[model samples]
Target: MRFQTITTDILVIGGGLAALKATHSASESGMEVLVVSKGTICSGSSFYPLMEALGCQAPTEDPEDNIRLLEEIRESSFQMHDEELTKIYIDEIRDRVAELPAMGIPYRKMQGGRIPCFAKRARDIFIWEDWNAIRNKSYALLKAKDNVRLMEHCTVIDTILHDDHIAGALCIDRQGSLFVISCRSMILATGGFGDLFEHNLNPSDVCGHGHILALDAGAKLVNMEFIQFIPGFMTPRYKVLFSEQILGYCTQVNDAEGRDLLARYLPSSITSRQCLDERSKHGPYTSSDISRYFDIAMMKEINDTGCEKGFNLSYDPKLLEDKREFISIYVDWIRKEQHIDLLGTKHTIAPLAQASNGGIVIDVRCATGVNGLYAAGEVAGSLHGADRHGGNASGSCLVFGHRSGAYASQWAKSCDRQAINTSIARKALTERFEHHRPNRIDADELIKEIRHLMWYHANVVRNERDLVYAKDRIRQLYEDFNPATHMSNPKTIGMAVKADHAARLSMILLECMLLRKESRGPHYREDYPEKNDRSYARRLMVQSTADKDIEYRFT
Candidate 1:
């Protein structure tokens, strides 16, 4: 196969809000910036709003309120976050959010002003009008810049290293053409691995490829076990995110067999009303509160019956009569945009993988402990701990996205462009495409197997036996699968590469889940039901050794 080489000062490997912010920051320095996306520009997790609008949280201008907000963040994360980074996030998020209005991003205004969605107090959140406005305006603004260029429908397979530092990246377009992206610096904003699960709300291309790329290039990952799972519609509209705000109004929840699923799994001590009330307080499932039983029951039901459709929920609007403020906005949006009437329809809901709370470990400046390599957005880890606040996902995209871009640009300007080594790219291509053996394994089937394994064994509820079995199964799949064998059909090469990365990442995530023996936040181990702060309080870091074996350490 032949290779085409493209040179740039900075290479950004995503098209989400974080990547756009990074590209915007880097372009201001007059450096040529190239953004490569797996889909169209501005299309990632950040642009896929589950509800009528997307919430971006920022501290209120009040000094005392900001202090309270900071404390709440630490409490919500269960002290799993870096205090330095938490402080930076609280101090800078307001200004970053304020800049959005100027870029043509409109905020949803209410009578009492911004309402706190997931927090008790002082956690001010600004909701964007919708995903379409944000994408169009952001795309138009970036396209107007001279130094910024965007390559859509392009997937970056791996990063190339020279003398233990990043030199460039390897990528493939939709047409099966190969390209070598040579750059002085590279930033990863590829989002998370929600797509690895059978049921997830993420885009198809977000399958933890960035995590694998970072690990392959000698960077450490932390909190791989702390994935956030939220309820999503499984019936009428599969994979659509279910609003947690409506959970409180649910009057009845039944399985496909028309049985009381929640009552069967929920302990007798916890009343159904109590459980539903607590569950409505947050979007993601967390063991930190009593609401965890709601998720546990749903998962147990799915596992017991092998019913992928989950449970049908019937709600009464009378329950939300007192919550006029919430109804006026959320319920109205549901009626107008989603075209679903909660009072008239019964919807099926299941626990769907939402976001990753852990990823590549980065410093305050967004450097991933590798020279010329930086990370931002959901792909960058440890800004959040076990559970993240409702809107902090978008907030982090703005803060770290800007930081990674500015810092990568500064680093690139101070250094000379690295020489390109075509041999490295050629060797990688040969190892992946030169095999003469017959292709026995299908990439599509392999991906399906991995997704099923993860959703059943490793998601939401985990135990030693299932996790160990999953780890071994993934390792076996990774060992047996070979993209080179399928080189005759070039269209399948990208899928093979994606499946390979998913298998490797699944192994690492299973290892992390096994290492943390205690249940904390979203990571619940049935065998070890209680949180053991003394034994497993610190963050766990995983990296690839020189021999290509996984090694982990506690910080």
Candidate 2:
């Protein structure tokens, strides 16, 4: 297949808030920036509705206090993050939040004039709106800059490397058009791999494509064992996320037996009602919170029931009746999405993989081990370690996006534009086209198989035996599955690529899980049962050697 080539100084491989911030910052440095996204701008996980308040941490007055808070947050990961990088992430958000108003983005303030801290004591800013305003305003500013260009509906398949440095990237658009983005530097802002799980909150397209790309290019990944599984709605068919606020008001009961399940996991001292009341103040599962046991109970129930059918969430109808405004807002969504009255009826709930706290290994400047390559946002790893606080996800995106952009721009400006790497581009393009050939395996079936295996073994509750079986199964699927068989349709091609990414990412994640022998934070190991700080406290790292053999280490 023929291909087109575009040259730029910096190539940004996402359209989320992090990518936009990077593009805008890079363009301001007088460098030409090109952004390529699988979907439309702001369509990544940034705008996903969480059914709870979403907060972004800004800078606080005291650096030591910020460090202490950040350290506490990283404790969820068992203190596996790089302290310097963590400092950069928590420090840079203050100025970034201050700059939001000038860009037409509003940060809500508390009545006492202090920023709200939803999940932690750190100052966090959030608004009633999801992310439409910030996304729109950021895109407008990017579009206004003459040097910044955006290519939507474009999926980057691979990163083209010249020796150790990034030379360019190969991408395919929705129209099945192939193109090459030749640049001096590349930033991987593609979000996490939540969609790798059978039930996830991320969009369908976020299947760890960036992880596979970086790994294939010999970049190291750390803390892959930590993925967050949050309580989510499944019944009423609305699948609306029931945030901590909503969970507090509901009673957890078995869907079929109508039995209270909290007693199975929580101590006798804490009643089910008390657990629900205490858990409502938190959003996701944090290792430090006593409510995490609630999540463990729900997940244990899910694990026992084969996870096909969800559990029951029953709330007092009078609660909604007391708050007519809340009911009025939800009634419309209930009718439109599920055609059922959610207040009076029992809804199904399950633990769904929501966000990943692990990703590509990067330094304090957000530069990966590979020269001229940078990772920002959720795509970059080692910041959150095992568990992520609620507001830190967006805050890290802005902090590192700004830092990575400036560093990448400086690196790009110092280098001379090299000739287009036609050989690498051609090889990558040919591999993509081969998927369309006849007599290949079905991508849909393979993807479904991968998701089921991951959700069963790699998520929430993981054991050594299950992880080993999953790793072998994923490897076998990767060996037997041929992408070319199901590539007749454009949509199938997309699914085929995502399936490929999911398989590779699963294998890597399994490797990380297997190496960490003790249970820590979100990387729970049923076999080990407890955290072993003596030997497993350090972060685990994995990389592809020149011979393609995987090497593992602890930093």
Candidate 3:
């Protein structure tokens, strides 16, 4: 069947903060913008506000507050993000928040000259009136834009390249119809790849399609190996993501052995709240002081004894009862309201699984090496080198998202149709159908096997031998690609393309993980236990040089 074709000056492939910013900037720049979201913009990974970890009491209005905090997080990302891009969004985050108020978001703010201390540390965290406000406001912006087109439940399969220039995109709608959308410039804001792991605090839709698209288009990637795990999101029965800001400040009572284990982990230099330095200068300051620093692998053994004790010890029921019934209601609300199947078995959690600290390579303009393509939000690798600070993520959404879109729109405005070719898009769509037909692998089985391998080899600890094992298994999975393996009755040719895009994302992370040998901030090496800042402090980049292999270079 002949598919429908749409044309715009620019196309943004995500519905998250970055895509919204890019679409807004493109329309504001007077360029026609088209946005295709994998799911409803509000339902994707961005909407899941893991607020328990926040130590803030209220949001900050200080103009300089966002900028100062972000510089610190960017320093954590190993100074890879452009300083120019970092400053812009951090400077404008308040406006982004304020915009929400106008969009039916009852933004929480100081009433009549009253400013409550939102968080314990004003510099490290801020309390949103409501995190859900972001999801609600974006709906209004989509409604108001005259030149902006919204394509919901759509997947961008690949780019259309003509003479090495990205000309347009190939997309598949939910109805099994192929659509070719041509745009002078494209902003890839499809977010991160947290689903590559077995248990993820991230929404499954965050498959890092933006990064994969850029790679296939010949753009270089940096630090794909570094997948930052938040120690708090222990899954199975509950998906409670305790805030880093709170843990960095408050005291944690780990009842693994019928009592708090934090006492055993506490060191001589500090005790109680003092042990967690609010002014921690580095990502993982002292190895013993970092996240999951004192090993609690024994806690798993303790978790098994919970069934005999009555109350499951993996998660602290005291957190719900003590924090309040409101906390329980709020946690339950996320599951019922958002379809997060996190309530099954009692699970033990450490401070892990927050935001991804690594992603695709981009300059101040949010452009990868490939022209006409840009990345933003969590998907675009920002300033979080080894680990990100508590307040820094909010800064990134404000900063990098704005810069990527501004540059994408400006680039779109200057281009004509001369550089575009729609052929590459057609090929991507056709190839997608080939992979989805009838398959033996179920999504559960495929994901389960993938999670097991990744978690075993690539979590907080890593060694050279296990990483090699990870590589071999991943290559085998790709060779035996099957889509109908987990058919949800929606398996059509179009969905195959999305799966292809998703698997490539997993591969990218594994490839990058294999190259980096030394341990850094979030990416740990059990074998290379020491941080050899001498040879590894520089950013590691993977460029497509010859044959399918990446050529690694340090900057």
Model number with the top lDDT: 1
Candidate 2, residue 134: lDDT: 63
RMSD of each: 2.1, 3.7, 6.1
Candidate 2 lDDT, 159-211, residue by residue in tens: 87777788888777988877878999999999998888888787876788998
Model with the higher TM-score, candidate 1 or 3: 1
Worst 10 residues of 2 by lDDT: 110-119
How many Å off is the CA of 401 in candidate 3? 2.4
lDDT of each: 0.83, 0.74, 0.59
Of 1 and 2, which scores higher on lDDT?
Answer: 1
- lDDT tens digits by residue: candidate 1, 1-555: 667889999999998878888888789899999999999988788877656667677766788877887788788777688778888888998878877765557775344443343466744667776677678888888889899888999888778877777888888899988888889899999999999998999889889999999998899999989999999888666777777867778777888988887788778788888888898888899887778888888898788878888888888767447455555577766666666677776678889998999999999989998999999999998798888887888889989999999999998887777766677787866664426544456788888889999999987889999999988987677666777765545576678789878888998899899999999889999999999989988999999998888998878
Error of 3 at 340 (Å): 16
Question: Lowest summed lDDT over 10 consecutive residues: which window, candidate 3?
Answer: 111-120
| Candidate 3 segments exceeding 4 Å error | 49-75, 78-81, 89-121, 124-126, 129-134, 232-237, 244-291, 294-347, 350-352, 418-424, 431-444, 482-490
Worst 10 residues of 1 by lDDT: 109-118
Return the candidate ranking by TM-score, descending: 1, 2, 3
Candidate 1, residue 340: the lDDT equals 62
Write down the TM-score of every candidate.
Answer: 0.95, 0.89, 0.77
